[model samples]
Each structure stands twice: as structure tokens, then as C-alpha cells.
Target: MTKAKVGIIFGGKSAEHEVSLQSAKNIVDAIDKDKYDVVLLGIDKDGKWHLNDQSSYLLNEENPKLIQLNKTNKGVAIVPGEVTDQLVNLSGSEALGQLDVVFPILHGTLGEDGSIQGMLRLANLPFVGTGVLGSAVSMDKDIAKRLLKEAGISVAKSVTLTKNKRDQINYEEVKTKLGLPMFIKPANQGSSVGVSKVRNEQEFNAGINDAFLYDHKLLIEETVIGREVECAVLGNENPIASLPGEILPQTDFYSYESKYIDEKGADLAIPADLTDELTKKVQEAAVEVFQSLNCEGLARVDFFLKDDGELVVNEVNTLPGFTRISMYPKLWDISGISYPELINKLIELAIERHQRDLQLKNAVYED
Candidate 1:
């Protein structure tokens, strides 16, 4: 059987660009070479897409640095055609070939926020991760929390502040409402970018200002005192949850620096020391959050397991980091799925979901 061509797209115009590069590098290394032919695509900070060589793509592997798009590499121009001729060189000199499936290893912003997914949908191509609606809703913390709350899921009490209402915010009132040690974050970012822990009014104001720099909407969530646990969910429908993992952050919280840059940022405890009953509860809640948000392909559902055994949904990451040290794959690895196997399963899930979607009547009028 001929190997399927898998396009691994990464390095997006987002705060998590570095994280995305790291993920793509790891994915390229672990993907089954016998089963799939890999194609590397990079989106630069300026949002231009280029087809990069394998050596150029894995430039960051040795030192574990962020890889940037090599401007000299052939530019990729989407031809907007049938499945066989979508991706081609901008000069139109080379067809570059077609992709059987695309694994977008990008995180945050335009990459994970449904823009690329929308483009893939228009191109009639199958790609990994959530669909447009799921990606959009999951990227926005405000919307995700609201939907999760409406679904009878417990979430941290929080308030959403938009740039227009910046001046109207009463810090004292916010303090009274959400209390101290608040978690301030950009509503649409991931990998903990522009996220801060505010203990006093000074930090609260600064955190909000910093968060607004990344996004117009900011979320101020009351601190939930519990173990920071996460569960990985996979599949389009009837998703299965991996054994929970606990994050032991060396920093005050899991900051961006701690997550990607810092060497001693955090430690993971797979199958987190929870009772069998509590473990089941966490897994069940993870699946609920995944389905509630209409997530497909895969997602990492974070939760706060309180001392009293209350499982509070933290957030759902539709395109969770796929770095070697990332929690999503690590949890699944502990649950008997190897790294390569996990990658294969995700790609299969994407294709399976696409085939299922093809069965539905998509056009409004019959031809």
C-alpha cells in the first residue's frame, strides 16, 4: 500500500508560535515514516506559508529552540481546487503534491482558532483537531466557560472584561466579586500566554492591562484551590478520556515561561494520585466537557480536583500542545498509548470524522 501524504502545518502568527514549532518538530520526529509521507509547512510571524524541508523544519530539535519559516524556502500558495491540487508553489513551477491528511500542529490564534480549519474545510481536505465552531468556541475562554456552565458543569466564578469597558472596571468591585488571587488571562490565547495570578489590587490592574495587550477580551477567574489535573480526550464521537495527570508547577502557577521556556517549570504525575472513584469522575467530566464543546479529533480537558473531591472544569484546549513534554500525549502514553501510536490514532480520527461528515447532505439544494 502507498503511504498517505501527511502535511504537518505549524509556526503560526500567535503568541504560542514557539510552542507550535516545538510541537511540529516533535511530531515530525515521532510520525510513522513507513505509514505516511510527511510534508512540512510553516506559517511565519507575518502569516506567510512556506513549504520547508525536513532539515529546515527540524532545525530546533537539537537545542529545542523555536523554528521560524525560512523565507528562501518555496512559498505555498493554495490553488483552491479539488483535493489533488490544493497545495502548490507560489511561482506555479512545482505542484508540491497533494495531502491525504493535514495535522495542524499549530497552537493559539489564527492557527488553532478555526481560521486554518475553515480554510481546510473550504479546500475539502481532512485535518486534525476540532471543527470551526468547536475551535472558535474553545479558543475563547469567555464563550467556553459560559457554554460549560450552561451545560451544568462547574467552572470557576469569573468576569469577562472587554477593551471598551476597560475604563469602567472598578478594581475594588472586581476584588469583592472574584476575591484575591485571581487568574487573569487573555480570552482567546493558549499555552498560558498573557496569563497572570493577581493577589492584590496592583497586580490585578497590571494583569488586566497585560492580558488586554494580547486580546481585547480578558477573563478574571477566581482562584480555585485544588490540584491542577488534566485529562486527554480523543475521538470524534464517543471520545475516551486518558488517565488523569497532575501538574506540579514550580512557579506560582503554570505560566508561559514555566510551560515552554523554563527548565524547572513543572512536573507531571500521571494517573494522578486520585482514588479510583475520583479518577472515574475526572474522566467522565473530561468527556462531558469535550462533547459539550463539540470538540472532535482531540482535546485536553483541565480541571481542578478540590480537596473535598469536587471536580471543577478549568478549560478545554482543542489543539493542546504536542511537544515531547506536553501533558496531553504524556497522559495517553501512561494509559498504554505510545507516542507514535497516539499520532497515528489522531490522524485516523481526523480521517474517520471526515468520512462520517461526507455522509451528511452538505449542500442546501440538490444538484
Candidate 2:
């Protein structure tokens, strides 16, 4: 049997570039070599795409901070258009090979915020994770919460602040509205990149500034005191959610450093210590959120399990982390799916979705 060619695109023009590199390395290492011909594509901070060598990129996995798309002089820019999966190299307009499916392991900003997904959709390429609408909606915390609320899902009470209205922010009014110990984060980022837990006026002001550095819009959410739980949702129409996983962050909260940089920053309890009823409820809610957003391929739905056992949707990660120890795969691992198998299943889902979409009557013409 001929192996499928899978393009694993990573390293984006986002703050999570390092995380993307790490995720790409892990996916490349675990993807079944006999089942797929892997292609490594890199996107630099300037958003330039390149055809990268898998092995050479993997070498930077040891110290992801040192990884950059410019590290290799062999630059071949890819322009995603022409309504085909055949990527063209800018150097000579040479064929960069046909791709069966692309697994974009990019976490934040342009990659996960629907920029890359939109480009792939225009190119008519089959790629893993959510479509442009879902990605765009879910990446923006403000819009996602509104949609989730409309879908009858419980989301954190948050006040959206934009760069223009930043000066008008009154700490006292904010404290009275959202209260202290709130979470200030970039409304459009993931992996807790610009997330900060504010306990006092000083931290609240500083957190706002820090969050604004990453994005123009900021979200100040009322802190829900509970265990940070996550559920992995897979498939398209009839998606299934994995067993719940609890995150015990060693730091004040699950910050970017806690998520990727620090080794002992957080601990995961797969199959979180929740009663069967609560677990089922969470899983059901996760699937609901997934379907509500029209997410395809896979997504990791985060939630806060309160002391009274109520589950509030934190946010939906359309393209969550894929490292071996990441919650998405870890929850599935305990739920009877291996890491490699999970990767394969995602690719299959992407292809299935593409095929299904292609069958739709998309055009009308006069005979």
C-alpha cells in the first residue's frame, strides 16, 4: 500500500512559536513512518512559509527556544492558492510535493486564529482541526463566550477591553464588577500565553498591560475557584469526548511558562477524580461545545469544575497541544487510544470532512 503524504506545518508568527516547534517535533516523531510520507513546513515570525527538512527541524527540539525558520538558508516560500494540494516553491516554482493532509500544530495568533486555516481552505486542502469559522470564533475569547452562552453553555463572566478604551479602564470599577483574583489575558491567544491571575490592584494593572502587549483586545474574567479540567473532543458531526483530566498548576495559574518552559510547572491527573455522573456531564458538555462551534477533526475543551460540582466552560482550544504529555492526547491515551493512533485518527477525520464537504452542491449555473 502506498503511504499518504502528510504535511506537518508549524513554527508560526505567534508568541507560541516555540510551542509549535515542540508540538511539530513530537508529531513528526510519533507519526507512523510506514503509513505516511511526512513533510515539514515552517512559518517564521514574519509569517513566511518554508519547506523545511524534518530531521533538521527536529534537531532544535532539545532547546525549542533556539528554533527559528531562518535557521536554514534553504528558503522556499509557499503560496497557498490554485485550488489544489500541490504546494509550489518560490525558488523555482518547483513542486514541493502533493500533500494528502496537513497537520498544523501551530498554537496561537495567525496559525490558530484562522489565518492559516483560511489560507488552506482557499487552497482547497484537507487539514486537521476546525474550519475557518470555528477557528476564528473560538480564538477570540469575547466572541466564543457569546456563542457558547447562546448555546446554553456556561462561560466565565468576562469584560472585554480594547486598546482604544484601555485608558478609560478604572481599576475600582473593574474590581467591583469582576472582583479581585480575576484572570486578565489576551482575548485572542492560546496556551495561556498572556494570561495573568490578578489578586490585587497592582497585578490587575500590570496584567492588563501585559495582556495588551500580545493583543489589541483583552479579557478580564471572573475567577472560578475550581479544579482546571479539560476534555478532548474528536470527530466532526458525531464527536466524542475523552475522560476528563485535571490540571494542577505548580504556579499561581497555568501561564505560558508553566505550560511549556518550566518542567515542574504543572501536573496532570488523567481521568480526573470526578464521579461518573460529573465526568459524563463534562464529556457531554464538551461534545456540545464542539458541535456548537462546528469544529472538525479535534479540539480540547477546557472547563472549571467548581466545588459544588458545576462545570463552566473555560474556552475551546481548536488546535490544542500535541506533545506526548499534552492533555488532549493524555486523556485519550487513558481512554484507550495511543498517541500515534490519535494522530492517524485526526488525519483520517480531516480527509473524511474534506470528502464530505466536496460532495455538497456548492455551485449553481445556467444550463
lDDT of 2 by residue, 130-185 (tens): 99999999999999999989988888888999999988998888889988789998
> Candidate 1, residues 262-356: lDDT per residue as tens digits?
76789888879988998899999999999999899899999998989888988889999887678998999999999999999999999998899
The per-prediction tally of clashing pairs is: 0, 0
Error of 2 at 10 (Å): 0.4
> RMSD of each candidate?
1.4, 1.7
> Model 2 residue 68 lDDT?
51
Q: Give the Cα lDDT of each candidate.
A: 0.88, 0.86
Off by over 4 Å in 1: 64-67
Clashing pairs in 1: none
Instruction: Please give each candidate's TM-score.
Output: 0.97, 0.95
Candidate 1: worst-modelled 10 consecutive residues by lDDT: 58-67
